[model samples]
Target: MHPIPRIGPTEAADRPRWSVIVPVHDCAPFLADALTGVLEQLAEDDCEVVVLDDDSTDDPARVVEQVGRDRVRFVVNPGRLGASATFNRGLELARGDLVHLLHGDDMVLPGFYSTMAAALDSTAALAAICRVEDVDIDSAPLYRTRSYRRGTGVWTDALDALAVSNRVRAPGIVVRRSGYELVGGFRTDLPHAADWDMWTRLAAHGRVAFVDEVLARYRRHPGSDTRARVLTGANVRERVAAIGVLAGYLEPRRRPWVTRRALVYATVFAARTSLSLARSGERRAAGVQLAEAARCLVQVPGGPPRISR
Candidate 1:
């Protein structure tokens, strides 16, 4: 392993470029490729890659060390600090003008940094986001791309769209350091939905630029965080919370549409949870989920009673 660069706070500020922060936890198998994707674009003088290993039980630290520490700064957490805490920590440690929160399982496509940096330079927005391609565990395409390009970049409508659906995947966003600090980074309370909450708050205060090209790859696996959120039904609660948050930002007429979508998503999530639990022979859990679904249905007047398959 090469010698790790002794990066001081001043040294990072002097670079005045992008800093890629990746929070790794039990993802040693994919960390190599993720780091490679980031380091390859750095141009030596432009950016630095920081990997915060949150007490990963896997051999991620060893691999990072073997890959050389000159371009990458590998920090090992004393204990497992969950994703939200890890991301916040990375933000605190980042020494760049801009921060890109790349997950350990995701990768940056070729020319990603240059393209986004140029976009940021041209615009006066606090952050810029690009379209993201969804890939399976084996890196195969998942048939649909996710993005946030509607509504002519209006903040209020963007907030509503985000509250209704998580079109802004975390990996696709590159936020300015000052803007990230202003929004207080990710919320530590909501472990599973902090990213959703953060983005909602981000759009409320500043302009967000959207690049239609797919510059990042978001990897989805059965054991991935997204999958866990879906299977455990945490996504429903997250979306509901997002709706409540957006109420403070959206117009009255738009509020109804946001509420309607929340209820619809909640109902569908409950049904999915019930069915999954039933298939696993957890009848009692399934019943509980069904009751929750019934409660959500009652909240919306004139709402459809049936949950779509």
Candidate 2:
């Protein structure tokens, strides 16, 4: 573990240790729960909440006002900005050492801030991530969890881990504000895979710490951008483009290996989308996804690996 740098008193007074920025758009139903969850964990004066309404049509301001604007600062965007831009706006407004961008529909579990903050403070890592529980619209558990590795510790093989898959879930991840600036914020272009691209870029800078516990809940509903894009088969191209960005950061010798892994990842992704569509009774969409998966397999250097149940 690397020693944490000591901060001067002047710096300490200017910035809070954690800035919880919730970006929302038409997520009124879940916004209250999200804010409540965050409010419960904020015990110290060194943390603050900033809710950015991304030109939401559904009165997100009412939700934040209900949560008490005195405790939570709220900002309504005059014009529409996408998720990445909205988050960037929040980042610009944040006055904290560690920046945490939580989706308005997602809720953080108890001890999320403390655990992640401690891990980050104890290590030289640029970011820290933990497991996330997948939940339904009503906050009911879906019995699924997302985590990058088994157990808890720092991840040294950041690039290879990302090459295998996006181990870091954005909602459960806490990043150093300086590190975010170093990476130049999230890419507005790679909308679907912007988080993946950001994670890879951060990993390139330093190690990423991991917490074993499920510190947050990611809502998995038809309304989410991810689910909607996946169902429509639009995320496939965005994902490939994201991998292209990842490839740019790699050494020439390692690019081929990573590219092969990326091809396999894309194939598996399409396969999953196809299976999901089949289960939803969308036969034509399922067939299209299958065809897309087959097309992606053609780019694999060693051909596609046989997938078994």
Candidate 3:
């Protein structure tokens, strides 16, 4: 199989400069909110919305029909294409200069469009990202990520920062279609952490504009992919692998410190999450997390942080 999800060359039409692609998989309950957020802000002539399903059991098509039937296009994969391919299909189908892969369960806040558009336009950035808030299933805000900058500006340290951390989530980010084409598609191998890998690729290629204000809400629930991976410790394991994939993108001298720093963060995070899960009586999941922590520790420089059983 190819190392990355392939997005072939295609003719570019000169209309609808914005494409809001919502990739769904059994996220019927929250699909409406996502469609609504984009529809409310879009200039109909300049934007198109596509809801692509990864062959989910849930009839999300029905939900899409009720949400914005007139304005949205819906497509379903013949079989599950996983996150990377599902997203690559969105990019392929997009006839827009800017593409936003707003996950079905996520929603953009008011002014999300105007602010992000202006940021990219003024800065000529390859991509633009804003602070994202984590929310519950009910759409109640839990917490927001730290500001990447004091205000809206171009990020100079994006590549370096992304190598050691993945603070930016998909909903809060928009990529220029041209830059994405140059960078290639998401890595199919890193199923759970492919977005992080793609972000590192983007940062490596060009500038990333940042908006300090929180402009998107990322739903964190049991049904979400990250949460599902957490149960089996696949999230941490994939992240460790993703972090390792980033080494090739950095300077030779910087690679060692970046890899070590990222591995330490992953190991500590897994170990701490394991203890928390264990205290909450999730023994099976906790054990899985602890094992992953051990695996990460093997690659981390220096000794592991102290952790109690």
Best by lDDT: 3
Deviation in Å, model 2, residue 147 alpha carbon: 4.6
Which regions in candidate 3 have their CA more than 4 angstroms from the true location? Answer: 223-225, 302-309
- Residue pairs that clash (backbone atoms under 3 angstroms), model 3: none
Tell me the whole-model lDDT of each prediction, alpha carbons only: 0.74, 0.80, 0.88
Per-residue alpha-carbon lDDT of candidate 3 for residues 229-296, written as tens digits (9 for 90 to 100): 88998889778878878888898989988888899889889989999999999999999999999899
lDDT of 2 by residue, 150-221 (tens): 777787777876865677666889998888767667777776677887788888888789888988998878
lDDT of 1 by residue, 195-277 (tens): 87777767777777777788889887787666565545565666666566656656777777777777877777788888998
lDDT head-to-head 1 vs 2, winner: 2
Residue pairs with colliding backbones in model 1 are none
Q: Which prediction has more favorable TM-score, 1 or 3?
A: 3
Model 1, runs deviating above 4 Å: 1-13, 147-156, 225-232, 251-256, 268-293, 301-309
Ranking by TM-score: 3, 2, 1
- Scored by Cα lDDT, where does model 1 land? 0.74
What's the lDDT for residue 262 in model 1? 72
